[model samples]
Target: MENKNKIYIDAIKKIAGSSKLLKDEPMSRHTTFKAGGTADIYIEAENEETVKKTVDFCRLNNIDYYITGNGSNLLVSDDGFRGLILSTAALKDTLEVNGEYLTCSAGYTLAVAANKAAENGLGGMEFASGIPGSVGGAVFMNAGAYGSEIENILQSVRLLEADGTIRTADACELELSYRSSNIGALSRVILRADFKLKKGDKALISEKMAELNLKRRTKQPLDYPSAGSTFKRPDGYFAGALIEKAGLKGFSIGGAQVSEKHCGFVINKGNATSSDIFNLIKHIQKTVLINSGVELTPEIRLVGKF
Candidate 1:
């Protein structure tokens, strides 16, 4: 334990600049669910250089590490992570619009990117108006809504490979599918992305975004703490519908409950632990499987201990 702390501290010092490093930072504050344990080493990298240095240090020291965007779709275990957590939330840079294309950093929020597109009179990102995640995370998951998806607009992505080298790839190489991309399964870290949009009237774009935002507000239980949809949509079926039909809506396990407002979401009512949410998810999965013969797969990424 002493040797581990020493190694972590040495790595932190080797990284350049004011990259903040914390030992055992609480995961609850980082995730949308507001439920998780602690991460052994948490580093907030503010720029590409710092991120590269941090990644290099971790690799050289043979440290276990994982990068996270906004943590909107993540569930960390109550027992906590035993390795480094790299947060790219500070890499918030955007280039000036060039024709119908917009270049943005990975750390930029989807809402921010959507608003930027709207501001520049660019259309096609209206579907992401209310997505509570960073640009990198959205692209990694091929995030979609309201009949539009990242695959429709993403042209290219800048990624940092597992060996600490940066590379660029076209959209075709990403292999995007329903809420997933090849990057999600690979070891590459997203640095930036280029999106292609249509030159549309600003008024029309704003109107469409407003309309979608209103729809999201009306349909989703935004008041509660959740990691959005709890389960992935099964082939030819919706996970929420199955859970609802299984009579699990409003079901509670500790402070975690299947949201009555939207059965697809398992929300933290208040003071919910990671264990509570995990148990609720398992229960819902079991019930849905028994009732409908459909195994519900999770959309939310689960990390840390069981």
Candidate 2:
């Protein structure tokens, strides 16, 4: 580590303690893809205050930092990141229900939140039951499955702004669209989110959740390590169908292969490297664009230098 980096690391240890700090932690262990090199520093923040303090410290010192939650939709490079990765995964995972609204911390898993909503006879969260991500990440990307999306139920969120201040903002202010949000552009961190749901039959809600999860298990490549849906659904064209029609399903580049079970996902076949996955994604994009008129765009977030 450089002298300046070490100095910041030592300073951050003082703010968040040595237990919260990890040096040269492997990115493969954090990401769902289970591929990539190590990170210089990884901080598992324990609460909102710790997150704020660390962000403030990094800003003041001009240290590069990236916030992560669950690492479900991330693909780190082989060279790894040279900066700090501040994760909300260790924060207090709490869910509270107040009438029609369900409030949860950023660290809370979407599956758990969906189940909790079903338990309380609240509907609308069933569509998110199978998404393998945290509330913060899901909200950040407007994650959706089986037609319903986070924007439909999201009411408000408590955010840590770029200026190191916390405030609640309405869902409309987020400009939640298809797999996009304004949160990252504004340099804001999601502390917590309030979801507005409707009262429904408890049995029906549970049944809907179970049905969606069943469909996911049958259609998605859940057995292998993948970052779920590799490409975004192009306008008027399904990415999976386009790839399949191009005869690229079950194709392999190194250990990275287009999943036979779901052509949309690029899966790591045991010993795949980050480079393999990256190359496979590009190949898929080029092939799909050549075969069909629609160009495919990656849905997963790339980290570090790829």
Best by TM-score: 2
Model 2 per-residue lDDT at 281: 96
| Model 2 lowest lDDT segment of ten | 1-10
- Each candidate structure's count of clashing pairs: 0, 0
lDDT of each: 0.88, 0.90
Tens digit of lDDT per residue, candidate 1, span 1-306?
123777567757568367777888998989999989898888777778888877887788777778889999999999878788888777876655789999989999999899999999999999997999998889888888899999999999988887889889898888998888877467778889999999999999999999999999998999999999988889999888899999998999999999999999999999999999999999998998899999998999888878
Q: What is the lDDT of candidate 2?
A: 0.90
Could you say which candidate leads in lDDT? 2
Clashing pairs in 1: none
Using all chains and alpha carbons, the TM-scores for the candidates as numbered come to: 0.96, 0.97
Compose the digit string of candidate 2's lDDT tens values, residues 1-306: 333466677788887863378889999999999998888888988888889999998788777788899998999998888878898877655698999899999988999899889999999999999999999999999999899899999999998999999999999999999999999899889989999999999999999999999999999999999999998899999999999999999999999999999999999999899999999999999998899978899999999888
Give me the displacement of residue 2 in model 2, in angstroms. Answer: 5.7
**How many pairs in model 2 have backbone atoms within 3 A of each other, for residues 3 or more apart or on separate chains, i.e. clashes?**
0
